[model samples]
Target chain A: MIGEARIVKLDNLTLLVIMVGTILAMSIFLPERFLTVTNFQSMSSQFPEYGLFAMAIMLTMITGGIDLSVVSVANLSGVAGALVLASHVKAQAMGISPGTIIFLAILAALVVSLICGWFNGLLITAVGVPAIIATLGTNGLFMGIAIILTEGHGIRGFPEEFLFIGSGTILGIPMPLIIFIGVALLVSLMLKKSAQGFKMYMLGSSPLVTRFSGISNNRVIVKTYLMSGLLAGIAAIIIISRVNSMRPGYGYAYLLLAVLLAILGGTNPEGGRGGVLGLCMAIVILQVLQSGLNILSFSPFLKKFIWGLILILFMVVNYYQTNGWPMRNLVRGGVKTGAS
Target chain B: MISKLFQRNETYLFFVIMAFSFFVTVMNPSFLTVENMFDLVKSSSGMAILAIAFFVGLLSRGIDISFPAIAIAGQYIAVNALIAMGVDSLPLAFLISCAVGTAMGATNAFFISSFRMQALIVTLGTSNIFHGALLVFVGTRAINTGKLPHCFKAFGHMNVLTLARPDGTLYGLSVFAVLLLFVIILTWFILNHTLLGKSIYAVGGNYESAKRAGFNIKRTLFFVYGYIGFLSGIMGVMHLSLIRYSNPNYIVDTELLRVIAAVVIGGARITGGSGTLTGTLLGVIMMVILEKNLVLIGLSSYWHQFFIGLVIVLGVSITYYQSKRQNRRNLLFTD
Candidate 1:
């Protein structure tokens, strides 16, 4: 039993080692510039948008549900922010302060994101639609709304101050990276220490048992998705700022990547297991691989293929770890073994 | 009579489709014409075929979101192979596509059956890999099939029956639409008549009980996923034939949602073990009609997505409520 526990504990550590190994391998094979500060800065800046979305997905996955509409929500929120900024910039020509406009735009984006999250919660809990189905529907709905609002064109030309939130550095660190760190810290604290977090894990492990224990599973689920929505909102701000544009189709590819990251981070798809630290390591590894691929001039599609391969490989590893090697039983003619 | 009809899931969908069609026709009488009606069916044939794949996967308690990717990949392979060989045989192209699709499906089945992973995640990973491979191996250029033999082009546009419009354009029943009907009948027969079909339901209904009953659960899952892939390949070929071109990026994103929505709306329970081909057929028609008429009703193509999403949630909600009520009734009776 102790040996099994030790092996289980080493899973995340093994993942970290694999991540570091990949980075080291990339550094050796690639040019000297690969390890330079500028490359690290660019990689760090590029990863936070995806990293933030992964964290959002991780929060919901912890509760045994998924938020498939994270990208759509982010797009919707970002579009809302962009519209606000675009209109406000026009007002700026009439002497309105850019600072206040930027603040208001940010607030608008976050608020829209919260509402979208709340709506997802209502669909799952109140309407009794399964999380995956509900979010799949809402994903379309949100993206459609964004398209209708923007008429299929990207909204661009944001104020310099707003762009700084995405592109500017503080203490030689990219702003988006700093924001990701702060969000990661807060999420980790919530998952590790909060009563709600405990309840989420329990609910994920056994919904019926949690309900019988007098915990309102509905409320927890709602709160969990709401947090996911909020994170997507934050991710939207970073993405829009980073690109200096907002469009309905922005970050469409990241939806799959976010799910991939969360799963690679060792979060159980069925829920009730995983942590922020594991997720952070997973994000860094993927970001490094992505940056490495970029430096090596690999096709973007190859990167997607690698992420997909990793997702399947990790799921297989996780299954074996949790279920205790199905092949052992297969070899033994389906007889139960004490070790299994 | 109404209550009895309502008790049957397909009937409710049929009425909904009828009501929706009536509303659309009322808004724009042009939509009521025979040509327009046939055109709608013709265009929807591809989606209906894809939905059939979705229906099969859902029935066996596994959801395959990779069908669209598989379809595009298979089509690309078939088209490129035909182009390289300088052949214009539609049947040969279809055969090649199905073969490629079977391989892709078998890959999904291998991992899913061997590992017992969640079908959703497995398919998601495979989808990315398939699309990525398509981009890397085949390249993203849209290949025009204009150089194909005249017979092949003629077959693609072949109409069984024709109706001449007042404006001198002719519209008629397409070969693809006929193919869809044949597929629907074949799938219905498989689901309702065959022993393998029975095994599929049994496995989905209760995995442990099915195992005890001597059913090979892994084999059933493998066969179901493979069958869906096979159908997806056919759909892919049909899609290429209809469009007269092949593009790697075609049918990437929103197509998956549409297929899922159609299956769910057709009264298939997401939890698995219960669904019917007839119900699925009605569901596909309803979705296709709504999509086609949305533009006629002055809504842009964008709103079509919003409505599809709305219908899926509403459809699932109704199913959830109905099932809950049934469970309550059963519990009360047992008590």
Candidate 2:
């Protein structure tokens, strides 16, 4: 409780401590079943997708923009990958080796996501549509295009080598987890060290001000969304590889959860403030909470209800920290009157 | 004159709607029928009501994704209570829905107004909370028509006007259309004539300026959100009557998106302080026709979501360019 109250001071290390403490506490609270290797392995596998999404959402949110279409872009990218990888796209007919085709599939998905992100960036920066509205529009546009192509059917059958990226363990660590860590580190380094990242923070704080400061606001904003799109593409590859199928209607479940996870990770919804460490911690906390809930057999609806309440609670906590406690003033006034 | 008309989003949309209807009619001659028009209005009444409600929130510089949840929960609670009391009166049910909805909206208002939380995030959180709580507390079993009261059934059947067909079957205009008209006029009067309405505009235009002007910011926010709740309640009852069924899951997510799209198409600025009832009605008409009568143009219903996405992107772009032009015109220096 004291640590939570101190987070109002906006110290990153304190927040990290709280997150680390939560993991430890939960372990102690649910030791016998939840602390096992299988449980840990399953959690490690599940969180990579969510963590990548949170990171993607975090990058966009850092620029005072949001990419609501990240899920759709992921689904679209997955479908793009699946189109090339699916057995129906005969290697014999195309006269291409399965190895080359798999490589092509990965490239195609990345290119598609880059284009989608560029499109989103253009809509917001060049067109001057607000980020929320622009992303909302593209959310439908991308999902609609994906649906049109796939007709809402699941595209299955990937080569084992490709599936290896999703399910295979590397030196006792899941491949997805390693990829996620690599991406997280790159994102953290970029945000903390790169000029473009500085420009993003400035743009988030105030676009007009950033423009006056000689930053090419549109370029920075576009690049932010573009990176966000790239991350979504990475998440999609992992998803299709893990699930061994790609479908257009597959990404809606992640949309809200991704947003929730990003907010939980301490990315301000209005933008300009976030860190990869906080984001990763948030992802771990949520994944652990989910695992704990599943172990306790909590219903999905109850879990949703709890997540919503926690989001609201955190929002309030954030508010009180920034603005000072209004209730405290009210209570102090009463205390003075009583003394008098 | 043409340039002046084209400068406004409303006129641009009006022209597009005209062209669209023309094409739809040329493809199928029955599109011009008054019967079809009446049917369009009647069928779209529920959506039109929600659009108007959505317009109110947008006008006050708030975006709400929770109205559908409120609409569903409000009606469900009201109907369930009515059923428990062994009563089946429509008016009482509507009143209960409004009360329940207003209460829910007040909770939203409390978070946003008191804490200055972002409307989108606050509503997003509330939407999940409201939905989950409803599903958790109340069972998700749908109330079928047989379980519904006679008043609701009668109201659902009630017509504002009736005309006999050549085949001797009567085609009647639904009361829902009249109700929609009433809601529109009521919103217009509130927006144009009432102090509370003007305050909404002022607050949306510039929050700090409105506060300086002595408008109670919290009060206005409370009213705006509470009114949304109140309207959602009414919509809930109307939906119950129209469907004559109470499904826990009805008109969520994409349906809400479509309404917001219609509102945007109608010329409601997401940043607030500018919109018109005529534009809103016209936008709703365009969406309804596209949704319901697209088969007349030999297209699949699957195409509508794509159209909606296109409409939103195009509509927002038009609005942005129009604002830019206006800004340029008002600029004193070339730089």
Candidate 3:
């Protein structure tokens, strides 16, 4: 038990140290911009949107599954919200009140995202496709639907109210940032203290035993997917509101980022082993890294290269620690045996 | 008779491809032209290589979503190397480009084998890192491959042979198309015949069992990732040759979907332990032909991406259902 605790404790604390270091580095490097109230506000605002994506992905990861379609689903919801709002007002038309539209738009997006997630879940659970393939297939399907609806164009001219939800400031605090923090706290509670979260871990860690324990396996899967979809919908609103436009191609970039955030935060791809705190920190670290690179005049391509290199390094390190390095195989009378 | 039916499950994806081809051809009369077919094959070559590469990892019961970016990085680096070295020879340039890709593959393997980290996560990280490194190395602008060497130009533009009708319509085969076919044949041979190749399937089927049977799962993973990197390297070279330029922005959502679809459509089971190079080739062709035909029939290029995704989902669903039923039947028989 002591040995196990050491491993678990190390994994949990690793990201906390990293996040603190990032904050320190940024404050020192770009003192005025990075440490300011305005900067924090701006950073926090963007966090909720990306955080929502991270949450959705986290839900799937906890279920021993993944959803590549989150980005596509978010894109669809963003476009749908924009289109519905735009078509009504005719001049970047928005006939609905700002608050009402925000609620309705999010609801609509969540419903669509849920349906898409359900489709993916059905394929994985019922048709028995692997999570990667099922999600990959639906990723294409959702994005394709977005393309048909938007015809490669964008939906713009949203009502001022929607923008406020994304951009509005309350007593020098960004609304999006507030929303993001609120959601994060809520999710952390659910994961850390809730009965369902424990059950989720049991299912993820040992589905066979858990099923024998009488957990509704299928319902749990569907429920996780539903939550993932809802989170995706929330991300859709924040993203479109931030950008002030909705393109069919939106959220394409977020797919990889969301996965990175989840894993970088210390959520295991093998499932039943991870934390939301680590993921949130990972997101902040990634965003800071991107911001730093941007400030340094690095080209976008260079940014991708940096991201990839770090990813590879971290993975290699993770692999070594988990499975012991320099893996050796046996030889049977001059014939080489395999490495485990 | 029942045994024969289960054996045919592997080949069912081909029927789907043929049906799609027929449907597209019916929608547009000119869809079956030799030139169009050649172009389709050429367009798919880069992604086809990736699909084959991906098949390696899948057979090992692991997945790498980062191959596309790796391919892009390899393409960027190789092209940059060529410009720096001032190489005018296509074959040598291709060789050097593949070497770079192989290095990337080795790096991926090192992490997976040495670190015990998840492939999905490692690849995801590297995808960003590789892309970022490429940008820093090459700067923001794309390297135009056509301006560099005459032989390199031929790689994208030159046709291997031509077929012409009395009516004077020029329809010919491309060297790139031939190259794609050769690669496919080579992959099928390796995957089917080689001891190392058979090990991949064995490991993916059941890693614990394979280990007990004296297989090196680590070495298998290393080789699988290395092979994928090699494919990506070849693709990087091929993609730069075809497009005549390397653009970082080109690594977008559409690219990931298309490449993955090609692999999944080729009848490669997502769960691993089962896949074929032939199936991947067909999947690549099906995707390319469908996209081309859709555009030819007046569907927007934007819509093509969306529709292709739908087709992949539908195709996979059908395949998954069929396999499930077959599995159930086998269970029943055993019982």
Candidate 4:
């Protein structure tokens, strides 16, 4: 437990340094635009959508699996929610209030996301397809379904109350930010304090051991994917509400970036290790870097290049730290790769 | 032997293709025509070639998502450089693109083998870097059909087999389809006859066992990725020539997944050390036929994506379960 805490703290310290240093540099270079309340508010509101996605992917990754279909699930769920809202908005004779429509929309999104996640899980656990491939298939299926339903067009114009979920502020703090915090805290608690947390970590670390220990690996993995879906649904709601548009191809760009953040937050692609606290920090760091770079008038392509470089650099350094260097491995009398 | 033969994904895929072709022909009599068949293979040649590259990656226990990006980048670089050199030689174009592709693929190899990181993320990072850098530094404008090299346009029109129709129109097998055959035969020779091919299978099956058995892990990684890069470079140029246009943004996004689907549907396991040439060829044919003839069979084109997804899931599932049934159950207790 002490070792885990120490390791977590060290990772947090690194993220903190990177975040603070980046903020300081950005403020110095582009203070007027980068250090404004409005800029901060916008950043806060924007990240919640993909931040939820990061959490979804993180859960699956912790199980030594990945859900590549997060973006498609988000879009599908958003489309589901949007269809409810759009149809009701058109049918004024239904006598449904705007509030009921928002609730119904949210419900539709949640139901679709859960089913998608469950399907992803069954594909992996029951059919025994690799997580990457299974999700890849589902990703196409979900995206195609959304496209067919929407007929390749975006559903736009939410009611004012529904729009508030995206843009509203509670006591001068943004609604999205608050919702994100609540969800983050709940996830952090789930990962850290719950017995299922132990099972997930165990499952990730050694599926063989978990299986022999009489723990149902299928149940845990399926549950993990289900949680992943729920998170994606939340992200869809946030995005659709904020942007006031739900389309078939929304959030595709976030797939790799979400994985990048998960890895940055100290999660292993091999499974059984990651933290909500670190993931949150990683999300904030990325959001700031994106906003800061925007303030400095960088092109979108350049931003992508920088992000790619950052991910590579981070992975290299993190790899060295986690696995130790070859020379260090020799000094410690460890085997090759130092993974075990 | 008979049981094992029937157990193959290729066998299942072959029957499915035959059935689908029957269905398509019944719905649209034109599908049975030689011209339509040639067109099908011609349109799918680039994909089949790329699917071979994908086969190598998946067999090595890694998925190379960056190949599409690398292919597009390589094609663009090679085209722009060739145009600058005032040359239109087809071989020279392939040589440049292949060289560039190998270097780019080798970059992925360098980071992955040296740092010992997960293959997916490293490739993801490199994919972004390569595509982003190309877009930012290189020009984004597409070279239209007329501006393309004369050799490329000519090659697009070249046919391996020609037959006269009663209406005096010509129809034949395409040169691009011949290229796919050459690629398939070449890959088959390498996989069946070379130590490098054996090493790829060994490494993919179990990295530790392969290393202990004296495989040069780094070399194996480099070769697979570089070879894939080499193949994609050719694919890039072939695609450019076949389409008679070069778009920097072409054959990316959903296109990459389609290639993956073809390879996977051919029974290539994501975990590695499986799949066959016959399966891959059939997979490519099935996907192409489905995509091209769906509208002719009274379904919207959008249904192709849905059906492709379904086939991938079903194919992988059936193959996995069949293979699983052959193995003994897991041990109940362990030391």
Report the number of the highest-TM-score candidate.
Answer: 4
Each model's total of backbone clashes: 0, 0, 35, 0
- Residue pairs with colliding backbones in model 4 are none
Give fnat, all candidates: 0.61, 0.44, 0.88, 0.59
Question: What's the true lDDT of residue B51 in model 3?
Answer: 81
Which regions in candidate 1 have their CA more than 4 angstroms from the true location?
A1-8, A93-96, A325-340, B149-151, B162-171, B328-335
Off by over 4 Å in 4: A1-5, A90-92, A326-340, B328-335
DockQ scores for all the models shown?
0.53, 0.49, 0.52, 0.57
Q: On residues A66-184, what C-alpha lDDT tens digit does candidate 4 reach at each position?
A: 99999999999999999988876675567878888889999999999999999999988877777888898888888888988888889986777888899899887899999999999
Candidate 3 C-alpha lDDT tens digits along B105-186: 7777777766666676677777677666666655657656545566666787777888886699766666877777777777
All candidates: CA RMSD (Å): 3.0, 3.1, 4.9, 3.2
List the candidates ranked by DockQ, beginning with the highest. 4, 1, 3, 2
Candidate achieving higher DockQ, 2 or 3: 3
lDDT of 4 by residue, B144-256 (tens): 88778788888888899999999998888888877888898889988889998999899899899999999999999999899889998988988887777898866457788
lDDT of 2 at B39: 79
Residue A50's lDDT in candidate 3: 69
Decide which is better by lDDT, 2 or 4. 4
TM-score of each: 0.94, 0.94, 0.89, 0.95
Model 1 over residues B33-56: C-alpha lDDT tens digits?
Answer: 877778887788889988988888
Listed per model, the TM-scores of chain A against the true chain A are 0.93, 0.92, 0.88, 0.93
> Each candidate: what lDDT?
0.85, 0.83, 0.74, 0.86
